[model samples]
Target: MIDQAKQLREKMLQKSSKKPSRQTRVIAVTSGKGGVGKSNFALNFALSLTEQKKKVLIFDVDLGFANIDVLLGRSPEESIATLLDKDLSIWDIIEEGPKGLQFISGGTGFDEMFRLDETKMNKFFHEMSQLQGSVDYIILDTGAGLSYENMRFILAADDVILVTTPEPTSITDAYSVVKMVQAKDPNVHMALVVNQCTSDNEARATAENFKHVTAKFLNKEIGLLGSIPHDAIVPSAVKRQVPFVLAYPNSQAAHAMKKLAHGYLKLPVPYKLGLKGFLLKILFK
Candidate 1:
């Protein structure tokens, strides 16, 4: 596994060091706290991106949680942990979700099936570079935390989409994440998704205030990607192990997700870095 990882690292360095015609768009969808519906947003947003004719790969890095796989009604036999076996590659672990969308599970280390050493895991990490070139977008649904594991993944992305609710605590925690991320990379593409908003007015008010607060305190311009309304269908879809957008494409929340997808595509990308650049930084720096 470590050998394969090293080979991948070399290839990435060779590619990223030189200029490229285009850079793949990578979005790290994270939050200040849990239960803000970050996973739901990530899953449906990937589907929406595919709807826009973009090839999307959703990586579930939320430790111990099986949100994406469960939501898609799938039980993946392989995960990042399986790559340590010396026989499997990332292609072997990827599982099809819905509507031609795909996802990779960041295995829970608790089980024997996923236990891996540093070098072996690095081998798995190296293959991520191959993915950087194959897909149009890589949506990372990272675990909600400030730990090194979470930061490493978030910092490596081309953009960071912070999910927060209208609640005071949610906003405060989201700001903390923004601050942490800013401290790491001030130029990082930061965006906001106000979820569970009850009304259009509330969504506007909450998103605007949060944006203003981040700009005032952090001195960062956080893009207001869009907001999702508080919809019962969301929970109902969860219970049915399906994505709300696929089940209720006409729902307000689903419609909001599509708008967010389009809004994301409209955001100007910082073209200085490509997938190879992000891969090198994440692996070595």
Candidate 2:
């Protein structure tokens, strides 16, 4: 599987130069804390984009708990760690998941990625630059909270999808993420996703209150992306190691994801800086 993926990547790269290039949207999907179903949402969201005939890649940069491969029931033989430890390029490490979604696993020892030497740093940036126009979107599944690593991912992205629940602590922590990011880069664009809601009214109220507070206190306006209802099918799909959108397409959560994807496409996109720009910000800032 790994060899086949690498070959496919080569073909794509070969044809890329012949085609007019467009900026690939880099979206970092994160949360203020864990247990809010952030990674699950990122996976399903990418799959939903693919359903719209857009090519997408999900990079698992969660450092501590990267599990995109586990969620797909397949183990990647190579990962970002491989690019550092071995003589492999970035394309050699990308693995394909279900529904033709591509992803890069954050293997164990991924923390070392932030401490690269000068030579490795250049090589890493140069390899990643090749992905500038290779896909329509690159969704980063970053770790939750306000860690330094997570902040780097958030600041470098074109937009952020902040995932949170209706719980008070979750709301508070989510605000912290926004506050910290604003402190560093006030120009960063962000949106909200209220997951695990019990009803539509609860979701609307949660999103409204959160947006209102950000506007009043932080003086920032966070867009409302969409919400996912608390459905048993999500957990069941997780247990089966299948994306809920595929395993239970008719379920409430699946229907919500499809709607979310459609709404996201219709929204006006903020200016993007592409993969090379993303690498520069992440490595320097």
Candidate 3:
């Protein structure tokens, strides 16, 4: 399976080598803790990006709860583990969700998959390199908190959007993530997204307070990537297995998501290293 995927990838790479490469931004969307609506935010955010006519792929790296497929009411037969264990190309594992958003599920055995031999690891990286210029953004929906797997993706990404809420515990944990990331790599660019806000004032206050604390303690200025209001339509859409941005486009949360997408696109991308650079950092750093 590995050899065949490699041969096919090489052929495709050869054909694409001569063409101008499109720079892909790899952004990791994570949170301080679970239940902050991190995964949901990641999914809808990707869909919102697609609404703006941008090509986006959201990879669910939350090994324990790989619900990107489930959220779309999709039951994928293959996942990242499938590509690692079976005969398939990286493209084979990528599944298209609502609004033409492409995603790859984080299969079971999330920990053991990386313990495999180095050759398979290299092949995986080589396979992923094909996506360097193939998409506009690769959003990695990583697991919350400072787990080893989550940190690897966070550190390697060109930028990370840390999702949090107005709760005190959520803010504390989010700050912890910032401190850990800053300690490891101060150059790692990170932004904050306060989700499930009751009002614009509350959202601004939450984000501003977070920004203030990080700057004062860690001397790190986290960018505010806007906030999402607490709308009932979000859970209803979730129950229906549809992204709110698609199911209820006129809802307050949906409108906020659209604005978030536009704001994200306008933000300065100062650390775009493309897919290959991202893989190198993840695999070797």
- Candidate with the larger TM-score of 2 and 3: 2
Any runs in candidate 3 off by more than 4 Å, and if so which? Answer: 1-19
- Give the clashing residue pairs of candidate 3, or none: none
TM-scores for the candidates: 0.87, 0.96, 0.92
Against the true structure, candidate 2 reaches a TM-score of: 0.96
Ranking by TM-score: 2, 3, 1
Which candidate should be chosen as best, given TM-score against the real structure?
2
lDDT tens per residue, model 3, 146-177: 88888989988998999999999999999999
User: Lowest summed-lDDT stretch of 10 residues in model 3?
Assistant: 4-13
- Which scores greater on lDDT, model 1 or model 2? 2
Model 3 RMSD in Å is: 3.3
Model 2 misplaced stretches (Cα beyond 4 Å): 1-6, 14-19
lDDT of 1 by residue, 1-285 (tens): 446445644544465456343357778899988889999999999999999977678988887565788888888777766666646766666666686686888776623323345676467657666676556777888888676767876787888889988999988888888889889889888788999999888978988898898889899988788999999999999999899999999999999999989988887767535567666666567
- Total colliding residue pairs, candidate 2: 0
